[model samples]
Target: MAELWKSLPSWVRNIVVPVLVLVLAWNLVWFVVGVVSSLLGLLIKGLVVVGLAAAVVVLVKKAAKS
Candidate 1:
C-alpha cells in the first residue's frame, strides 16, 4: 500500500489526495450534523409533549378540586 502511494505522481499526491480527503471529511461532518439535528428535534418534540401532558394533568386536578 505504501509503495503504491509513493509511486503516485507528485500532483496526484499533493493535490488529488488532499482534495479527496477534504471531500470525505466534509461529507462526514454533514452526516454527523444531520444526525445530531434530528436527535435534537426529536428531543424537543418529546419535551413539548411531556410538558403539555403535565399541564393537562394539572388543569384537570384543579378543575376537580372546584
Candidate 2:
C-alpha cells in the first residue's frame, strides 16, 4: 500500500486524496446524522404511544371508580 501510494504523482497525493477524504468524511457525517435523527423520531413516536396508552388506562380506572 505504501509503495502504491508512493508511486502516485505528487499532485494526486496532495489534491485528489484530500478531496476524496473530505467527500467521504462529509458523507459519513451526514449518514450518522440521519441515523440519529431516525432513532430520535422512533423514540418520540414510542413515547407518544406509551403516553396515550397510559392516559387511556387512567381514564378507564377513573370511569370504573365512578
> What 10-residue stretch in candidate 2 is worst by lDDT?
8-17
Residue 13 lDDT (model 1) = 99
Instruction: Give the per-residue lDDT digits (tens) of candidate 2, residues 1-66.
Output: 999999999999999999999999999999999999999999999999999999999999999999
Give the Cα lDDT of each candidate.
1.00, 1.00
What TM-score does structure 2 among the candidates reach? Answer: 0.92
Compared with the true structure, the alpha-carbon lDDT of candidate 1 equals 1.00
lDDT of 2 at 32: 100
Off by over 4 Å in 1: none
| Root-mean-square deviation of candidate 1 | 1.0
RMSD values for the candidates in order, in angstroms, are 1.0, 0.9
TM of each candidate vs. truth: 0.90, 0.92
